[model samples]
Target: MTRLLIGALTAACLVPAGAAAAPAAADLEITIRNVLPGQGELRIALFDTANGFPDEPASTQPTLRQRADGETVRVRFPGLPQGRWAVMVLQDLNGNGRIDSNLLGMPREPYGASNNRLPALSPPRFEEALVTLGPQGAQIQIDLKQP
Candidate 1:
């Protein structure tokens, strides 16, 4: 397989993922785990850095608000163009716009990214998180915080 850099994100030239020579467009179901209990709301954004950070809409946004307590949440993005994309997740501890962080440079509020990539300890490389989307759809998991 050949890897092409379309910006910060890399696109993999996927061969027919089976008997199919190519895949038609499909949806992406993202599962988020380890959410803080009683977390008020979560905001997830989709973008294609290949197009210079052009934004792609998630099925919802500051969407997927949680009312009670839970460790995991699921969100879906439908009709994602078959290409390279990047994701940003914000945990609105108080349903606020800005994210809160500690003096140690650690997030005090809920926040995450594709592959659960962190700032320092386990920052994800482009190749490590870049994924191929197909007609059958795919699921990517992101851990909520730096546990």
Candidate 2:
């Protein structure tokens, strides 16, 4: 038992102090882009899952709100827990309903996800959009494309 305790203590000492401690909150910088016509009031949310993957739980909710710029936007979110994260953004053009899309199913309006989620032939998956926020909140770029 004494030997086991000494071994455990030695192992613990080998670990980095910061790594053992809780990660510091990070300053997150979010970039929302690609706004179509008629797409107005926009909102963004940052979520986290234990691992970067297809299905994960929201670790945090950082609301990003702004007007339609019809271009890429840079929004700064300061002081966020460090972990694997994802983003959710919507272009609420009319106060009435959700973001409007065209007949082709392409976004007639603006809406986006994080990790620079670019939809291919299919929609962007959660794994493709997972971001890592370390000790210091990270600066990430996200480009939203509608399909």
Candidate 3:
């Protein structure tokens, strides 16, 4: 019994402190404002890189599709690695799973990006909408724009 106890203690001491502890995950809370209630559904995408960015939802690590039931909607993404992230949200009024645009290449649906940035005569870039998330997590608000 004493030998077993000593062996267990030795094994525990061999492991470094915090080595057995799991890495802290980041939680991102996004608040989308000015959503068109009862329009259609809100397509939200979270991107970790500039590959797809504000345009491609399939390139995102995780995407969310929810109904636009209110003027303001909150979505929380948990268990994400601590790093930079960008969020793109659009109210799909047509339920066609894509943003509707006009003949001039201007969006017809309500859309918004992280940091509430909407460039004139251009689309929002991933870098401009990036939000840093540490172990402490982050919260951002995006206001929808009607073009």
Candidate 4:
């Protein structure tokens, strides 16, 4: 009887607080503002790794393609795991699926990154743009930067 009680206590101690309840799905809602009022598509990409950050959309974990009609566009990524994530938005003004850059490698269209982080020389790093998402999820607003 003493051994059984001790084993039970050990098992309870091993279980973390709130372990009985499963964690909620992490959802992320991103609002892209200051978009040029015109006909275009907003390409939003979510990255969980530093492998492909703000510039590489194809390498992102999940990509969201939405229409850019008004001054702002909203998108949501649901059922995401709780972790650090960064977002990148590109306003394809020419309806092109990709961001158009000039000869000098400057973006010709409006673009934005999570946490509104912008780099002076190169694209924003994942660390600079990352947001911690919890079980309750999070909402982030990014302002488009026109060049």
Overall lDDT per candidate, in order of appearance: 0.61, 0.66, 0.90, 0.86
Tell me model 4's lDDT, rounded to 2 decimals.
Answer: 0.86
Best candidate per TM-score, number? 3
The alpha-carbon RMSD values of the candidates against the true structure, listed in the order shown, are 12.8, 6.8, 2.4, 4.1
Q: Which 10 consecutive positions of candidate 4 have the poorest summed lDDT?
A: 51-60
Task: Tell how far residue 83 is off in model 1, in angstroms.
Answer: 0.7
All candidates' TM-scores? 0.62, 0.64, 0.84, 0.80
Model 4 ranges off by over 4 Å: 1-23, 58-60
Per-residue CA lDDT of candidate 4, range 7-122, in tens?
A: 99999999999898876678899988998877688989888888767677555288988888789778899998888888989998888677888888888889999999798667
Residue by residue across 1-147, what tens digits does model 2's lDDT show? Answer: 999999999998999868857767888887666765445676667666534232223444566677766577778878888787777676776754455656765555455677666564444576677788887678877666654
* Strongest candidate by lDDT: 3
Tens-place lDDT per residue, model 3, 112-140, is: 99998899788898999999999899999
Ranking by lDDT: 3, 4, 2, 1
Give the per-residue lDDT digits (tens) of candidate 1, residues 1-147.
Answer: 233355324323343346565556778888887787675677776655433221224343223344425678888888777776566666677776556666765567766677665656433344445566766877898777733
Which runs in model 3 stand beyond 4 Å of their true positions?
A: 1-22
Q: Locate the minimum summed-lDDT window of 10 residues in model 1.
A: 50-59
